[model samples]
Target: MTVIVREFQPADAAAAVRVRRAAAPYTVTTPASMVNEHRAAPPARRYLMLVAERDGEVVGYANAGLAYESSEPGQAFATPLVDPAHRGHGVGGALLGTAEEYLAGLGAREVYTWVLDAPECRAFAGARGYRPTRTLRYQRLDLASAALPEPPDVLPPGVELRTAADFAADPRPVYAADVEVTADEPTDIPFGPVDYEEWLADTWNDPLLDRELTAVVLVDGAVAAFSAAHTDGEGRYVSAMTGTLRAHRGRGLATLAKAESLRRARAAGCVEAYTSNDSENGPMLAINRRFGYEPCATEVRHVRTLG
Candidate 1:
């Protein structure tokens, strides 16, 4: 079967989302988010999402870019996803080849990608010069059956629970909180301080992110801890990111924000909630378990070095 890989078009949003869902089921993705990401991609990153077609239908897709935001040099990525039914054909390999060629041309000397923790996936990456590095596990929570925690009626002396909606007028504060939390999360490589403009254009304006569903904890009138949320119109919600500043580490603020956000999600009719955690993050893993989240899938991070 002949497979063709080409730059993604705006009209391919729906098919691209389907391919992603088939390949990485736990991650949050929607047609609108796909379009937003592809359109708002920063020029510095040299970002591209390529789609592979077989028999005139989209069979796979790839996300490729230079990690321009990383403090370290030579970092980049090209993640490919192929529909299960279309696998074993040349689709995946073709898409991956195009992705790597694009990244390498952009001066990338090192590239990273996530492969599902399975024999075939490992062997596939290993055959292509990728080496296994770390593991990440996806967790699932049934919002429909969960006895979610209630929002606290009373607050800790200086803490207040709020929503992202409250900061709509000026989201720089939320952006400040996000960079703090993101800098602390485990990463495949070290990232530089985030670009506020990029965050505003891509993340802040992401269509899937639900401002009211996102729960925030404010301390002394400043954004402290928060849970970011994204939802597909079809009753599926994702715990996009949750974080607390290093100064507020042990205050249980992350837990409080996530709990409140999950409660809000269920109330808003989301039935399936999902999140991923690095295997080494015991603290966050335990916190998620406490919320009755169960392990669903495991993925391994793979890296390849180019000449």
Candidate 2:
């Protein structure tokens, strides 16, 4: 096979989305989403989405960049996905190599990637100097079958539910709330405060983000909690990120937002919902459990420090 790894082109969006679906079935991806990612990537992150071509057909892709969201600089990530049918043909290895080289050129020292909890995936990362760090479980809920928790008839005083669309005119409040919640999320490495412009580009403006399906909870006229939702032109709903601000902790705001989001998703004809959580995030795991979400897949966060 003639293997060529190079920078991704807008024309390859369909092929890239296909490769992602083939490589990771649990994740929902679309061509439009791929295009949005490329256009919205911040320069400081040195973001590069690369594709592996074999005989003129894309067989794999890699998302590489510095972890600009991290307070600790020099952190980077390079996630490579190869079509299952084209695996073990050096496509993945080549993509990883190309991605690492590009990220290193952009001043990345430590690279992190998520390796699926499969023996082969572990071996592949280990062979490339990447070692297992922590595991995250991908939970799935059957919106068509599983019984979702009922939304409370009455939210606590001064609290009201809304959608991301409600803040379209001015989203800085949502941005501020996101920064606070993201800072408290469980992860292998700590992340810095959020960048509003970056958030607007990479997150708020993401094509897959369904503002209508995204449920938000406002307290005292302020964004308190939200369940950012995404869909891939299908019935699957993904909780891209769900969080509550510090001031709203222990108020069941997160649960309220997510529950309402899921309910809305079901009403919109969505048949399934998915979300991932770090193993150490007990509170989130418990909340997900309460939503009838079941562990469907797991992936381990791997790190490789290059000299």
Candidate 3:
């Protein structure tokens, strides 16, 4: 069987999303979200999405782009995922090879990817010169049945909880809090300051972002912590990001924000809630556990250096 790998098109959005969900069931994705991500990519990142078709049927896909937000240049990423039924048919290889060539042409010195923790997946990456760098855990919660914590009846002085929708008029404060919190996140590629315009285009306006479900904690009318929520409008929700500013750390502001977001998500008819965290991030992991999230799967970050 011949496998054809080509650039993704808007028409392929649904198929691509299906392949991704089949490959990583714990992750949340939608056709609209896929289209939005492709259309909103910044020019500098040179983002590209590739699809693998077998006899006119989409079987695999890859998302490749430079880490444009990193302080270090020449850092790129390519994540190739193949439907389980199509594995071992060269579909994944074709998609990944095409992605790597394209990224290298765009001057990527190092390419990173996430490989499932399964032995076959790890061996496939290892055989291709990729070395494991870090691990990430994907967690899931049964929002329909979990015993979620109740919010306090009396709010603390100067502390308030609000949804991201409240800031539709002005989101700069949310952006500021995001920047500060993201900077403290541990990652192999160090991130530089995020440009507000880029954040607005890529994140704030993303079609999948659920502003009503997103919860924000404000202290004295200033944003201190927030939980960004993404929903696929099909009973699937994911916590895109949840963090607290350094000054608000240890005050349980992030926990409060996330709990509120999850509660809102449940009330809005979301069934399953998913989130991911770096293996080294203990605080967030503990918080997720408190919310009855259980580890569903793991992926290891792998890196390959290019000449």
Candidate 4:
């Protein structure tokens, strides 16, 4: 069986989403989200989504792009995933090779990708010269069955809980909080200063982000913490990011935000909730566990240097 690798098109969105869902069940993705991501990619990212087809059926795909937000130049990323049913047929290799060639032509010096913790997945990456650098844990919460913690009926003095929707008129505060919290998250590549315009366009306006389900914690009218939520409109919700300002770290603000967000998601008809954290992010992981999120899968970030 010959696998043909080609650039992804709008018509391939559903097939691509299906392949991703089959390969990575713990993550939430939808056809619309896939198409929007491709259409809305920043030019600096040089993003390219490749689909691998076997006999006219898309069996795998790879998302390749430059890490434009990273301070380090020439850093790129390429994640190739093959449907389990189509594995061992060279689909993954073909997709990866095409992605690498494209990135190299764009002057990529190194490429990073996530490989499942399974033995076969690790072997495939290792054989291709990718070495593990960091581990990421994916967690899932059955929101429909979870006994989520109840928010206090009486609010703490000067504290308030609000949804992202409330900030529609002026989201700069949310944007500022995001910049502060994201800088503190653990990552191999250090992110450069975030551009407000870019953040507004790429994050705040993302098609998958459910502003109503995103909970924010305000301290004396200041954005202290927030939990960004994403939904597939199909009962699958994901915590895109949950963070607290440095001054509010130990006040349980992040937890409050996440709990409220989860509750909101459940109420909004979402049944499954998913989240991921860098293995080094103990605080967030502990918070997720407290929310009854169980470890569903793990993926290790692997890097391959290019000439």
Candidate 5:
């Protein structure tokens, strides 16, 4: 029987999560996030979540969509995966072809995706017209064995520690902090100005965002730095983003926030923590290393321009 690729259905979600996790274990994923992403994507995004089935079993999953939030025109993304148990088949190639065709029809002139750094994965992307651009390092810290720094007995002058939950009644300040930090992140594609409504829908409302586990730092009552926490609800936690406002750089605010977040996560029964950083982002990478995060995997970002 031929492998079949089609739009993901509600019934295919569990299989899709398994397939993606098998192919890419470095990132945090849950069935809820997977389904929420597909449902919450704005219409302008034109997001299409696709899954591949072979012999009546789902073995591949992919998502392709236009970059509606990007001010840069002709930008798009397509990330595809085939389960390790099913890679010998042509599922990956079939998914990519379909994704590219959809993107082309959407008037996207360039396509980007992250491929695992392994030789076979690199070769697969290379043969598919994608050229490597930047490398990202995926790091993991064994919270069970980590020697997390202890919070000081006395608070630093004029500094206060809080959790994202503290601002539940008014998350605008948290959203504002997110916007400022995200804009400064180093990336291949610049995220266009983020919309408040979209941010609320796609990020703040995510089921995995445990506000109580997310550490926030306040400098004189202003949101200065924070580490967003996403949990799998099963002892797996990821620091979605650790960022400090430009004004707060060099003060170790980000490091403080992330450390507190991780310590709290471990105490919350989380056994493992993971995060990714661009190889060139020396500051954040150093912070992770200081926190005992060891490199587990790497991904090479590849881009293909449509003719």
Candidate 6:
């Protein structure tokens, strides 16, 4: 079998989505999301979406982009996913090779990729000069089986609950809150200030994002906690990001927003939901555990310094 790697075209949208879904089923994605990721990519990001074709069928894909949102420079990510059935055929290696060359050409000195925590998966990255950095988990919740905490009758003083849709005219406040919370998230590296315009283009306007299903907690009429929700055309919802501002920490607002979001999600016919967290994040993990979410899968973040 001959495998050829090439840039993705409009016609390859469905194939790309299929390859991604088959390779990583934890997140919900669509052809539109793939296209928008490229179209909305900033110049500094240098984003590229590539696919591997064998016998005229796409069996693998790689998404490479500079970490433009990070305060630091020369940071990039090239996440390559190959169909499990085609793992030994070198499709993954080829995809990584192309992704590295692209990122290097775009001025990236350090690249980070998430590899499954398995002997085979680790060896694949090791052979390519990647080193283990940290581990993250993909968690799942059976909305039908889990017993969620009851919603409080009334929020604490000066605290209110809302949704992302409530800030239709001006989402900058939400964007600011997101930037602050994301900066504090546990990671190998820190993300500095966020660009509101870029956040609006990539996150706020994402096609899969469901603002109505998203839950937000407001304190004194300002954004404090939020749980971003995503859904496929099917009945599955995922919590993309759930965080509370530092000032609101220890108040259980994160849990409040997440529980409300899950309740709204199930009421909207969503039967299952998913979320991910850094293995070292105890606070978030405890919040998730309280909601009966269990570990379903794990992926390790690997880093490689380019020479």
TM-score of each: 0.98, 0.97, 0.99, 0.98, 0.98, 0.97
Better of 1 and 2 by lDDT: 1
Error of 2 at 79 (Å): 0.8
Compared with the true structure, model 2 gives a TM-score of 0.97
Name the 10 consecutive residues with the lowest summed lDDT in model 6: 187-196
Clashing pairs in 5: none
* lDDT-based ranking: 3, 4, 1, 5, 2, 6
lDDT of 4 by residue, 63-176 (tens): 999999998899999999999999999999999999999999999999999999999999999999999999999999999999998878988899999999999999999999
Give lDDT for model 6.
0.88
- Rate residue 86 of model 6 by lDDT: 87
lDDT values, one for every candidate = 0.91, 0.90, 0.94, 0.94, 0.91, 0.88
The weakest ten consecutive residues by lDDT in model 1 span: 146-155
User: After superposition, which runs of candidate 6 have C-alpha atoms over 4 Å from their true positions?
Assistant: none
What is candidate 2's lDDT per residue for 20-80, written digit by digit as tens? 9888877888999999899999888888999999999999999999888777888999999
Error of 1 at 192 (Å): 0.9
Clashing pairs in 3: none
Higher-scoring candidate on lDDT, 4 or 6 = 4
Pick by TM-score: 1 or 6, better one: 1
* Model 4 CA lDDT for position 281: 97
lDDT of 3 by residue, 25-135 (tens): 998889988998999898888999999999999999999999998989999999999999999999988988999999999999999999999999999999889999999
**Runs in model 2 lying further than 4 Å from the true structure:** none
Stronger candidate by TM-score (2 vs 4): 4
What is the Å distance of residue 306 in model 3 from its true position?
A: 1.2
Q: How many residue pairs clash in each candidate at the backbone level? A: 0, 1, 0, 0, 0, 0
